[model samples]
Target: MNLSRPLLLASNSPRRKELLAGLGLEFKIRVKEVNEDFPEHLKRAEVAEYLASHKADAYQHDLQNEILLTADTIVCLGERILNKPANYEEAFEMLSALSGTSHEVITGVCVLIKEQKAVFHDITKVFFKKLTKTEIDYYIRNFQPFDKAGAYGIQEWIGMIGIERIEGSYFNVVGLPVQKLYTQLKALGLIS
Candidate 1:
């Protein structure tokens, strides 16, 4: 099986790299400056998916018969969308809102190769147990979850202690919907 077409990952996320590596497929990474902004009319899930596809559009020139994968994840609660934290106060606020509450984690995936393009989004409903002020403070002070959406990592200590339940793909919360991704990759002939 000489299934190779030069897979390229258009992201700078470590979690995305880890998840893709789990598929046992070799890939190279490249990123371009693409505007993450989306139209204000778009809602929660749409925001993530739209940005994902738009982000991949920056690498259209690099397609060259090679598949390019790009993704974006966001934590949405109520009408608010929580992206990566810009500062400690915002991170604290995001965590505080998420405590003892259920929120949706939406991850949007874009796979493109030449004229073929596929885009999809997955949603995971995660319920966090009532987190204490001290617990939140500890996680914020120690772990410094500035790079993760919603100021938390589902695979981290807060998730270990605070996550009560989840509905939908667990990997989605971790950043990539691996099973769905496998299906899409297979359908798109990106993998064997």
Candidate 2:
């Protein structure tokens, strides 16, 4: 089909852009806002997957015979879903709790083409080093991690200094799981 149609990224995340760019595929972004909420019955992975698929739904009419990608990443520590922090205090609290702990980073993704849609997710286990109060405070004040889930960025200062190790895809901690995404996109004939 000759790349049939240009790939459309239904997100504004810079991390997603970076991840997609690694594929060496051409794509364009059209920011469309979607609610990050889900039903109370939805569990951890379900919430992420549902939100990602919902993002793709925004471009249903705009989509032709092309691939539209959408994704949502969430951090879960125990039963608590630590979403993006609202303020510095909350951000500090989130990071403090994450210190010296392992948390799950789940990303739900959707690859939509016309009527056919593939929805899936990748999980990464990130372990942080025990961060001192001063270290956490420094990160919060310097990075202002309002754009990141769990109030921290894996590629930022906190990640470089605080993240001790990870058990899964590093890119997944950053945002998108490029390896899984590559396999899925190739299987769906979304990329060369």
Candidate 3:
């Protein structure tokens, strides 16, 4: 991919940074403070897309022909949205709820180039083997995934052993859907 303008990533997530870098695209990181609060009526994918667009909108005033990227990931089981856990106990509870069940990992991405903007999302269905309390405790103690949505990282130890299978883009679970992002960038004429 080629770009005429510099790429700006407006997220603090290392996973997103790593995934984007893997595509061999050079970008500058610019963290923006935005409230992730969404309307109560939004569910699943809508929540992520809304938050991602909200993050991108923060840079609207300062954008200058730069391609800005922003994304949000959410884990959904049934109708419940499992956001980043605030505490260890919440982490344990969220994992326990996910044990031996299938959940959806939705990653919403927004690409902004001046006045042109595109918002899209990818959903990956992940199945976890029944996790033991000891395993969950060990993972929590060792990884301390408090900053990650769903209290877990798909590229971490827990994902290696706990996740039985996934039905969609694996990178989406990690944080960013690179394939989708690349396609979107090409469609937007930001890349070739």
Candidate 4:
């Protein structure tokens, strides 16, 4: 596809990088350190979008002709937000909470082209079958899900066995809503 400007991906996530690359879109990785903190009032999906926009804001001055992309994903179970696990115990707790229950996986995407910017989000409902302590422990020990939200990756072994069903884009649960992002990019004339 022909693009009007260079594409810049402002993230260090390997999942996001792989997803963008799967779209056959050429982009350069340009990450900037940004605090992921959000307002205490923000809830569920709002938190993801706010953080994504915040990440984009860090490169506001650096955007010349490049279209910058930033994204954030969060796992929500009821009113609580399950962020990346800080340790093995946290991972276990997060997974245990999600076991045999339906939860929302929200991913917010930000596309910025100079002064013009578009921020949107996609939510996927994921249902997991009851997970035993042994299953959770084995998965954690083998996969070491310290870098993933909700203490798991939908593309991993836990997802394959534990996930009972899902409603909405699976890619969103993985990280980047590639289809929505592609459509948005094309609509913005960033890619053809």
Candidate 3 structure quality by residue, lDDT tens digits, 90-144: 9999999999999999999999887798999999999999999999999999999
lDDT of each: 0.89, 0.88, 0.93, 0.94
Candidate 2: list runs displaced more than 4 Å.
1-4
Tens-digit per-residue lDDT, 1-192, candidate 2 = 235568888888898898888877778987786777788899999998999998888889987767888989999998788999999999989998999999999999998999699999999999999999999999988889998899999999988998888999999888888889888877876554
In order, how many clashes per candidate?
Answer: 0, 0, 0, 0
lDDT for residue 96 in candidate 2, whole number 0-100:
89
Q: How close is candidate 4 to the true structure, as a TM-score?
A: 0.98
2 or 4: which has the higher TM-score? 4
* 1 versus 3: better TM-score goes to: 3
lDDT of 4 at 96: 98
How many backbone collisions does model 3 have?
A: 0
lDDT of 3 at 3: 77
Candidate 4: Cα lDDT at 32: 84
* RMSD (Å) per prediction: 1.3, 1.6, 0.7, 0.7
